[model samples]
Target: MSFWDDRYSRDEYVFGEAPNAFLAAQSHLLPKSGKALAIADGEGRNGVWLAEQGLDVLSLDASPVGLEKAKKLAAKRRVKLSTKLLDISDYDWPAERFDVVAGIFFQFAGPDLRDTIFAGMIETLKPGGLLILQGYGPRQLEYKTGGPGILENLYTEALLAEKFSALEIFHLGDRDGEVAEGSAHVGKSHLVDLVGRKAG
Candidate 1:
């Protein structure tokens, strides 16, 4: 079994069944109704929440075990969530198809793969589409709450600005905060958030 598959084989959702706080706070920016892409959606917390908000959501992840759980969560929430098994590194991203793309706490990729995924996220957005992203900052290593141990996998304001330069970034910053997502992500944390819009 894959690493993530093993991680998710347990009965409980590793990251809980609630949407990421950062993503949930962007409700005002969400489109009334359109397609949304939830990257590395794990157990469908964020994706199912998006579906609850009346959007067509596609939850993509590298773990079938996680995707299966996501499907179950959608069923429980009475929302429609489509899931796809994707490795992210080699997936063919669609062009200008989604109204919103959320990548909350998806910090598994190193710089090279990150660049590819970030670019594809931009490419997949329709004009004026919203891009919501959140990740652990360098300080996360110190916090030891959650996220990759690799410093290179963490995000900085400058890195996000440079990678998503094509988008019209309105909010980008990092700060120390309490992250109580689930058993997997809980306690003091360093978080980075970015909200950008693709040009119309």
Candidate 2:
């Protein structure tokens, strides 16, 4: 089994069942009703929350085990969410685009995949759409609290600026915050949070 599959096979969620703190804090910005895509949504917590907010949500993940849990979590929340089990690298992104595109803690292997994924993200957003993303920063290595140990996978403000050049950056910075994502991510952690709007 792949690393993600093995991770999901466990009884507990590696990143917790709750939505990412950055996502939860940005709830006010989400559209009340519109199409949303949660990319690399591990167990659908963020996607399900978007559905609860009345948005039509499509949760995409590579792990069947994770998607299965996402379904259950959606059901528990009494919300409807569509789940797709396919490698994000192989899957075709939607052509039309979405009102909101969320990428919470979706780290990639290297620059090639990261560039492609970020480009796909930009293309997937409708004109004037919102993009919410949060990930561990380079400083996270010192904490060793959570996230991929690989430094290459971590995000930086400079990298985000380059990636979303077309978008209007509303907010982008690295800060320390309390992260409670199951046992894997806990306590004060350094992270980068970005909120950008696609140019209309």
Off by over 4 Å in 2: none
The TM-scores of all predictions, comma-separated, are 0.99, 0.95
lDDT of 2 by residue, 5-42 (tens): 89888877777778887888888998888999999998
As for candidate 2, its clashing pairs are none
Candidate 2's TM-score: 0.95
Query: Candidate 1: where is the Cα deviation over 4 Å?
Result: none
